[model samples]
Target: MGKVLTQDAQRFMVDCLKAVGAGKKPALQQAELLIEADKMGHHSHGMNRLELYVNDIKTGKCQPNNECKILKESEATAWVDACNVLGATSSHFCMDLAIKKAGKAGVGWVSSKGGNHNGIMGFWARKAAKEGMIGMAFTNTSPLCPPTRGKQPVLGTNPLSVVAPGAQDELFYLDMATTAVAFGKIEIQRRKGKPLHPGWAQGTDGKITVDPEEASKARILLPLGGGEMTSGYKGFGLAAVVELFCGVLAGSKYGHHVRTWSLAEGGEPANLGQCFVAVNTSCFAPGFQDRVAAIMQHWRSIEPTEPCLRVKCPGDRERRNKEEAESKGTVTYLDSQIKSSAALAKKLNVTPMQVTAE
Candidate 1:
């Protein structure tokens, strides 16, 4: 593995984006989105995705400089066109608009279409939380999940995130995909030459399998519960609900129509759909933050079922990861990631990143 300073990693990402014709601000915003994921230990959405973004921009599948426009609006709702902009650009635009609207209307809801792959839905959700409001975000991705008992994949992992400020500097955060696991988990296991956990995915036969190789090739992700015996269909229902907030509401590519966005770059624009919502807590009774903090505190104080582990709230793990990463001032990448990143820099004619061994 190679360790790179976080700031330098961010710089390298921005440079790569710029090499593909993204403007300064857009490149930085997009890079920040990726870096934050790495910082928060969500490698699936972080630097692991830089190559895809670079290739998309290089191939004109994503327009980093395009301006998102509000197609229609009311006091509390908006319909937007991302104009094929980079995900971070459109996400920031919509989330900020939602926050502004919530300030006036008690709640703001925005739906957008024509978006590219937006990294980490939680990033946008946290934006509203920073403003002392409840933040919610959802987005549809390329289809990688099959409906229950079906042979072919149809729906996406389709993630949702909700975050809010809490009392005593605590926070409530939840970001999750409807699938049992992201396809990236399969890739990570495959890279390590390891088998997958049961229920993580389905094999070609559309049944649960533990072979990483087969699961990756099968590409049919199971819902959260895995199979009918485990009530996986309920997880499937939740995924459908997220789709309703995104592609169905935004009128973009829905369900099976969304294309598979693999590691390659030469396809049409993703044109994914997304939703961002913000609700003002001040609109409710007083002591909202205090109540939230108290609840989180109660959860944390509970006795652990296992002596080696302690109970934690939704945001606890991510917060700990962020704090640790900051204290170290560096992010570690797999040796494979370092090699690919160097290769990408050479391909894009950008300065390569410096790394520390150990």
Candidate 2:
């Protein structure tokens, strides 16, 4: 592993974005989104994706400078067209609209079309949380998850996220794809030459497999509960609901119609759909924060079944990851990641990330 200063990583991402003709503000926004993913231990959405975004913009699949516009609007709802801009840019536009509506109407709901892969859903939700409101976000991706008891995939790994602030400096955060695991986990396992866990994926035959290579090639991830025996249909249904909020509501390419981005780039515009919502907590019953904090604290107080492990609330792991990374002022990346980033920098004529240690 190589440790790079956090600021250096951010700078490299910003520089690379600028090299791809992204404006300064959009570049910085995108870089910060990726860096926050690394800080939260979600490396799949971090610097590893820089090359993909660069390729997207270079191929004209994304217009970083395009302006998003409202197609229609109501007191507390809106429909938006992202105009094929970078994911971060569109997300910020949508979430800002949601926040403004929530401020006036107590709740805001916005659906967007013609979007890109917005690194982490939690980032959008946190934007609302920071404003002392409950925030929610959802997005639809390419088809990767098959329905329960079905052989062919027709639903994406649709993800949903929710975030809320609580008293005593606590936060309630939940963000996850409806699949048992993200496809990126399979990619990591394939790169490491390790077998996948049984519940993580299925092979081409559409049966569960522990082989990483097969799973990666099959590109078929299991639903959140794994198999029919484990009630995976529940996850399948939840994924569908997420899609309803994004693609269906926003009227974008949905389900099987969504194009597969895979690991490579240079495809048509993703035309993905996304949803953002914000609700002012003050508009609800009083003491919402105290109630949330009490529940979280109670969960943490539960006796652990294992001596080596302790109970945690939903956001505990990410909060801890961010704290540790910030305390050290650095992030550790796989040697391969560092090398690839260097190659990306060379390819784009941008300054490479400076490695402090290896």
Candidate 3:
């Protein structure tokens, strides 16, 4: 039988976040965002990140309850200073503020500075879509991917997300990292002693590698499609665009200017940046909602070649995972993840989730 666990992972994560530094509803909201991602099978952005956050807090990279402040604002644009706030909380606040601004002006753009790594971008965009606004968000992270012609890690696995609202809380969403695989996913694989899939990364000496530990230590990830001949160029270009917005445009670090957290060294400075925009499709054309509905309907109506596979929209898989996790109580985490959480909680003087009876 598969391992079983109890307690809503969201609540437990929230408790731990609160116990550390999150300390309020914003932190709780951020915790839920990550927990939801894990439950929905986006393991790359899930509970595995908790240890990183804990290290961030302990090392002063993330502040507890340090709400970001607006550095500037206009009818359709804004800038925020995260004040070293947790990325999940800060990004959510920024996106909500943008959505509110867009409701008044029909569009809003906001760039943020000094934020830590937020969870998945789709998490925030879906919020705006749910509120009847078209949502888009982008973020930059520590350099983990090599540029098209370069061998060293210089660009972040910058991500982009877009969401459109539909009938019955249905949503059309696209959220993707610009890399073939995020470093976090690679790290998880390394911890589990698993091999990286073919075409995911290159070693320091510019050779393809499948050993996760080796990949983590001395390799750089390829772009979304693996190589230029395989459409990785497109993903590389998109990642650069986001970097321009979050780094150059926001006046923050770009390329290899970021520092990453490691368990041994504790939290270190990561001067990251991000951008978010909300569009009121209603402003662009009448019957925009109907048009979106039609577009998605047509996409989903496409016939599947294989009977076992069904047409899937960006957010569909995640939503289905959410349903399964809700019914099953807690999400199933790898043993390493369980131990990591326990260690962090013990260090912080809080009760961690009991992963197994042992």
Candidate 4:
């Protein structure tokens, strides 16, 4: 493993994006999104994704310079065309609109089309949380998950996130993919030369497999509950619900219509669908923040079944990870990641990121 200053990682990401024709603003915004994921210890969505973004830009699959525009709108809802812009540009635009409308109308909902892969859903949802409102974000990606009891993949991981602020700097955060695991996790395992955990993915024969190579090639992830007896169908249903909020409502590419999960490779644009929502907490019951904080505290105070393990709130782990990263001012990456980044820097003709021995 190697460690790089968090700032250096962000700078390298920006340099690579700029090298691939992204504007200063979009590159910086996208870099911020990725860095936040690293800070929160969600490495699957952080620098691990940089090369894919660079490839998309190189292939003209993403038009970072294009502007997003509202296709239609009402007092509390808006439909937008992202115009094939980078995900950060479009997501920030739509989330900002939602926050503004929520300020006036008590709630706001925005649906968008033509977006590239956004790093993490929680990043967008947290924007509203910072404004003292409840926020939600949802997106549909390339199909990699199969329906319950079925063999062929038909739905994306279809992630969703919800975030809200509470009293005393407390926060309620939940971000999850409907699948048992995000496909990026498989990539990480493959890079580490490790096997997949049971129930994470299926082989070509539709049975669970621990071989990372086979799982990555098959690209068939199981739903959150793993299998039929475990009620995996519930997860499959949730993924479909996210699809409804995104592609179905936004009129973007829906399940089975989305491109295969891979580099851009001269293919058509992703045109992924996304949704954002914000609700002003003040418009609801009184003492909302206090109630939220109280519940989170109660959860943490519960006794654990295992003596070595402690109870935790939804976002506690991420919060602790962020604090640790901040204290060190660095993020650690696997050796494989460092090697790949060096190769990417050479390809893009950008300065390689400086790493220190750990």
- Between the candidate structures 2 and 4, which one is better when assessed by lDDT? 4
In model 3, which regions exceed 4 Å deviation?
1-8, 184-198, 207-216, 264-268, 354-358
Could you tell me the TM-score of candidate 3? 0.89
lDDT of 1 by residue, 136-234 (tens): 999998787888898787889999999999977899999999999988889889989999888789988988898988987888899999888898888
lDDT of predicted model 1: 0.92
CA lDDT for candidate 3: 0.79
Return the TM-score for each candidate structure.
0.97, 0.96, 0.89, 0.95
In candidate 3, what are the lDDT values of residues 121-188, reduced to their tens digit?
89888778877889988888878888766788888789999999876457788988889977777887
Badly placed stretches (over 4 Å) of model 2 are 188-195, 262-266
Instruction: Give me the displacement of residue 206 in model 1, in angstroms.
Output: 1.9
Candidate 1: 10-residue stretch with minimal lDDT:
259-268
Report the lDDT tens digits of candidate 2 across residue range 1-358.
9999999999999999999899999899999999999999999889988888888888899899999999999989999999999899999999999999999999999999999999899999999999999999999998999998787898988999999999999999998999999988898899899999888898878798999988878889899999889999999999999999999999999999999775464668999999999999899899999998999999999999997799999989999999999999998898889999999999988989889665
Tell me which of candidates 2 and 4 scores higher on TM-score. Answer: 2
lDDT of 2: 0.92
Give a tens-digit lDDT track for model 4, residues 121-157. Answer: 9999999999999999999988888887789989999
- In angstroms, the error of model 4 at 261 is 3.7
Descending-TM-score candidate ranking: 1, 2, 4, 3
Error of 4 at 339 (Å): 1.4
Candidate 4 RMSD to the correct structure: 1.8
User: What is candidate 4's local distance difference test score?
Assistant: 0.93
